[model samples]
Target: MRIPGPEPRADGGVGAVAAAGGLHRYQLWLHAEYGPVVRFQLPGAETAVSVADPVLLEATAHIDKRPERLFEFLAPLCEAGNLQVLPTAEHTPWRRLLLSVLAGRPSHERHFGQFAALATDLADRWAGQGDREPVALQKDLTTLSLRMIGAYALGGDAADPDKVVTAFEEVLTEHLGRLYQVPVPGTEEERARRAAQALAHLRATVDRVIAAHRSGGRTDRSDLIGALVEAGERPARIRDTVMITMLAAHHTTGVAVSWTLHLLGRHPEVAERVAGELDRVLGERPVPDYADLRRLPYLDMVVKEAMRLYPPGPYGARETTEALVLGDYEVPAGTVIFYPFWAVHMNPDHWPDPEKFVPERFLPEEVAKRPRLAYIPFGIGPRSCEGAGLAMVEAELVLAVLLKRFRFRPAPGHEVTPIERFVLWAADDIHMLVSPRVA
Candidate 1:
């Protein structure tokens, strides 16, 4: 079947996509203009097929191989192997290990108190500031998420949390910001040098943590480092795993909550409902624990709806291993299939007034009316985010704690723009005025 898309410009199809601004924006336009399946060209690959329909995705869901070329940006960070493009034989075991640790409720429960305490520490700081200036919502929240993950995974706080966060940001900005660019000798070499330094700093930090765990300086085999060491994972592999875990777990949860707060800022009514739920459920408790999550359904809906609008990772891709048919389109072996979740989340067919913020849209009855894959903020199938459960728990708890204590309003004149930076993040960072809630 012939796939419809924009005609390739003189520079080529990839150039056309760039002219459309960003990949997410181009995908949205392609789906709107040419229906669910649109074929477009990339630099080295043949025509890539992008499927926007959630139902159509099921046919390709079982294909678990990631596009190696698409993930090469992560190559520098990993020494044991290209962690981002592990062979199926290798990926399965690695993913299974991560799932065993990340998916289990016990791991989350074991660390819930730490997570709550860390979140409260930030809230306490905000209270101290007392609106001296609007909190850099995304910046501070991202730092908090990183700290939570590090403490949970390593079983303690980093020796220098700020340094670690700074290192990670430098590495990501250097590598991810110019993912597909051709190398310029001098400029590229300088970027690589800085990236390498940043990567070294991160690796050093993880190395210290692992060393502590191994020598009995710290003993928490239930934590990720101890668990992996127990499982006999090599030092390099453990370090790589720690780096990747830090990268994956941090910004996504932070961005999700930031966007939710932004939406609630716009809709005071929804904010009131979230505050009400938190007040009734949490009462005198300043933060939530594992059990409290069940009692806060509206807060859950608000987080879910926020994710639907601004999913941490805007899109994911799977390279077709065998010929597959999605709708009327046939995707041949080796074709890269792009799943544009932002577009799917905004698909008008499944969501009425898709752009509007409406938490009730996630109410059980309303959710049941839509297709199962229609709202894939964390993705679907085997390759979906393994931290989905952990992220939700972390997000819901943090939201409950922060909202229960202080109400967030977008600082006047600050505009929040969602941009793809590995994860969807506000362009200049989200700024919110923090105020103490009257009891």
Candidate 2:
């Protein structure tokens, strides 16, 4: 669709998206300017015309009303043909129907306790690890989050957590890195070979896990995969759908949880406040349950703030089905509409003092001040994240349990910077010095 004329000016060339003032400046545009909707062309390829307008940010999750097609920029990762990226088809119902499990009150309650317990275990480990020790924050958080999803929510065996974690991590990062780039830069034949090999590896690993479950079957817990198999509509599609959820539910939560930990450690007052909340709600309890999650409002707010500051999957894009208009500019079909969430979350207009770590901003009164779509962590609308509830429960419990047991201080001389990978990651590898609490 066309919008205002953001055509190339004669006097100067438009900078590439990576260098286009970066996320720091884009955040300003999202809040203060509202809609610069700058035209960004990925270097060396004619993938599609990209837009960054929030006005046109319609929620496209509805199967019948399909907003637009998921753009190819998310390819390879989108290659799994997961429900998130699936074209509107018979499988569309799967995405909708699956929501019942993710929704409903008790599922949320069931998960909160699991999350709190895991968080406590993690904190206890951290508390015992001495202040001077180097705790690889990302690895720890990612492992814990993934395990929680696989074992508790999605119900995979927690017995071999490390093996599953490694396989999951590898498959995710490998595909994610490739998907981030435009047109596989390597030679065609070579690229094809690599792609085949990677997909085969991923499918095989996932299949083996599936087979193991089939042979042995569930003891007491059921994972998302189990739900998919039991549902049994489109077997192939359903399997792929569950796999994609695993990948999404896997790393995104980990990155978010890690970011929260680093932020809390760096800002001790926030940690202290989080600890105080735990004291009032948790008392001497070993862990929290789904019921206890609601009581930890401060922890919830902290995660909400963390997500705004640093989104798990920073952006998403959709392709226009046919030529249409966006604002003042006339656009053609195939244009990729890019929504830079990281940029939007940091906008001061939407969020006061955007850069600060202020969980209090998520308090009911503070949240009431903003628009509905303004504070999207799991994203906005129906097609938003299916695992949002699962992610939140996992995070809150982890934060609460950890805060109750230990205090983390940022290691001196360690510069933690966010590097834009397929997903935003702590470039310096988020190292937090661990120390046991006196109590």
Candidate topping lDDT:
1
Predicted candidate 1 versus true structure: per-residue lDDT over 271-331, tens digit per residue: 9988988888878888876998999999999999999988899998889899998878787
Q: What is the lDDT of candidate 2?
A: 0.62
Measured on C-alpha atoms, candidate 1 has an lDDT of 0.84
What TM-score, computed on C-alpha atoms, does each candidate reach?
A: 0.93, 0.80
**Which residues of candidate 1, in runs, are more than 4 Å off?**
43-46, 180-191, 217-221
